[model samples]
Target: MAGKTINPTRMELTRLKAKQKTALRGHKLLKDKRDGLMKQFMQEVRRTRQLRKRVEEGLAQANAAFTVASAVMSPEMLEQALMAPRLSTEVTVDQRNIMSIAVPVFHRAEQEAQPDLACYGFAQTSGELDDALQALNRVYSDLLELAQAEKTVQLLAQDIERTRRRVNALEYVVIPENQRNIRYITMKLEENERGNTTRLMKVKDMVLQDAHHYKS
Candidate 1:
């Protein structure tokens, strides 16, 4: 059944058509935004995949080195050598906008001097331990980058889904409803107009008959 629209007049029809036009324009804009976001989301996804692979490889290398070092060195000696740290790290978080979405950016403040990866005495610690530490340090920046990319991808995916749902609602629900209302109003108005025209014609015929009878 067609949905009923109250006061099916020309004015109402005009209003409904205007609303439909606006809805179509808005739907188009939202679709464009969704597409743009998808493109950016895919870019971030690819970057995250590559960074994750690199991070995993670096960690594996470091773990292998640690395993070799453990086999040769005494646990007590390793513990004593790595028990204390000499470097301090400061992490700061900030945000940047991407397509109206704010994403986190993490930074480790630059140090006055580059810290030595070697925390243990060379005389006592195995060279394998040093290699392991170096490997881990090498991937520190990559790890942060991977985190940023993954987070950006997550946010973009959420926004894309939201935009898509809204677009669908306008395309399928709001616009269609307005169109139905407009059609109903137009039909009602035309029907009323035809009825009025027929009534006027009947009145005109009766008046002419009365005049003819008076003349007779």
Candidate 2:
């Protein structure tokens, strides 16, 4: 099946060789990119894990504090105290390219700064409410970071899979097929050259015989 559609000529051989060279180079580059992406993905996974643990712990503490506050305060008072928030945060999303993959970057684009998490008068809100709000505030940054890290890991993994497929195609399919075609073309060209040489020799021998007969 090799070189079935290819012309058995020097030109075709040269073209196949060039294509094979390019494929080999591309295969190497894709492999490198895959390796780099895998490394970045692992690092992001570790960071995400740590961020998740911290966020979970912070959330737990916040929940416990809220429970304690809820038990002591009347339902109406608790709802009224949290009616208005002092701090507001806005996140801006951008992208950064990693090995040709665009991964998300999150920034706190706009946020209102507050001296403390307390939005209500100290007289009305219990101390446990303050503790709960503080805990939620502390975890906010980590929660955003975890989101970014997890998203980056997902993008990297997808790119790595694509790169791996390309590498495999070039390594196991494209390059090998090109090599086989080149070999087939080369062999055919050599066989044609030998056949031409033999025919020329036969013609020469016939001419000599005719000259000898004419001389006799």
- What lDDT is reached at residue 173 by model 1? 94
Give the winner by lDDT: 2
Q: Which stretches of candidate 1 lie over 4 Å from their true place?
A: 110-115, 214-216
Clashes of 2: 0
lDDT per residue as tens, model 2, 13-76? 8999999999999999899888888888898899899999999999999999999999999999
* Residue pairs with backbone atoms closer than 3 Å in model 2 (clashes): none
Once fitted onto the true fold, the runs of candidate 2 whose alpha carbons sit more than 4 angstroms away are: 113-115, 214-216
Candidate 2 TM-score over all chains jointly? 0.91
Query: What C-alpha RMSD separates each model from the true structure?
Result: 2.3, 2.3
Worst 10 contiguous positions by lDDT, candidate 2: 108-117
